[model samples]
Target: MVENEKDLKDLETEQSALSEEETSEQHDAPSEKNESSELEEALGKIASLEAKAEEYETKLLRVQADFENYKRRARMDAEAAQKYRAQSLVSEILPALDNFERALKVEAADEQTKSLLQGMEMVHRQLVSALKAEGVEEIETVGKPFDPQFHQAVMQAEEEGYEPNTVIEEFQKGYKLKDRVIRPSMVKVSQ
Candidate 1:
């Protein structure tokens, strides 16, 4: 009976010890919960930062592409400006060229005048050469088929030994600046 009583006391002490341990664990649980909430907040911040980074990267790429397009457009505009720089000057000189052609067709009166005319002819040739070097060229007219792009038919005539719609005579010469026609040829077309 005394041994049984000692065993009961021992069991009571063990039960009390287990209850105290459970209370200590309950007291530590709030700190573990705080840690878990902080970890969740940190993970959410990381996700938000990653989304912002992706958005910024997309904006950066769009800005870069826009800059490239702007550069290309600017370059093309500069090239066009440079290419057409001499257009006005060339246009102004064409009428003078027509006058020179008319003067060359007239017969010289005497030897002195003939020499003067020859000098003028040389000057005209030099002018033509200079214009040619600047990308000006005479449009072909005589014997070629009349084309509205380069030739203007002033008169039509039935001519033998010539194909219909062929240019038989050029009243005024035509010229081109590069691939573009500056003036159309004034011509007589054989019907």
Candidate 2:
């Protein structure tokens, strides 16, 4: 009877140990599930932050490119303004130059008139020199191929010993300032 009681006690102890181990395993499983869920949440937050940072970086690059383009355009406009600064003044002086040329072409009848003409010629030379220094120049017309950009065709004639569309004569002179035409030449073209 004592042996049977001892066997019963040992079996009861083993069963209690197994039940304790099962309770511990159940508690550990729930803890492991909680840890996995927390890790997934953290990873999702990290991905969202990374996406926002990437979007901000893309916007920064675009704004930087737009600012650079604006600066380049402003620089080009300043250069253009500096290059054409003398255009308006040169235009205003062209009619005076034409009148001077007409006055210089008249025949002097007396020595006093010739002396006055000589003084006028000196003034004309100084004006021309000033214009040349500012990059103003006359366009070539006679005996060259007619270009509508530099020459305005006032008349066309069938002339011998000249190619068609060639400039035969220039009635009014044309002037340019640094490759920009202030006025086109009034010209006769051969047909």
Task: Compare the candidates by TM-score and give the number of the best one.
Answer: 1
- List residue ranges in candidate 2 displaced over 4 A: 1-41
RMSD of 1: 25.1
Off by over 4 Å in 1: 1-33
Instruction: Put down candidate 2 lDDT per residue, 57-148, tens digits, no spaces.
Output: 76567557666776798899998888778899999989989999998998999999999999999999999999999889999999999999
Global Cα lDDT for candidate 1: 0.83
| Per-residue lDDT of candidate 1, residues 1-191 (tens digit) | 35445655765675576567557645643444577786876686578667656755765675576667767988999987777667788899999999988988878889998998999999999999999988899999999999999999999999999999999999999989888888899999999
Lowest summed-lDDT stretch of 10 residues in model 1? 24-33
Q: State TM-scores per candidate.
A: 0.74, 0.74
Each model's lDDT comes to 0.83, 0.84
Which residue pairs in model 2 clash with each other?
none
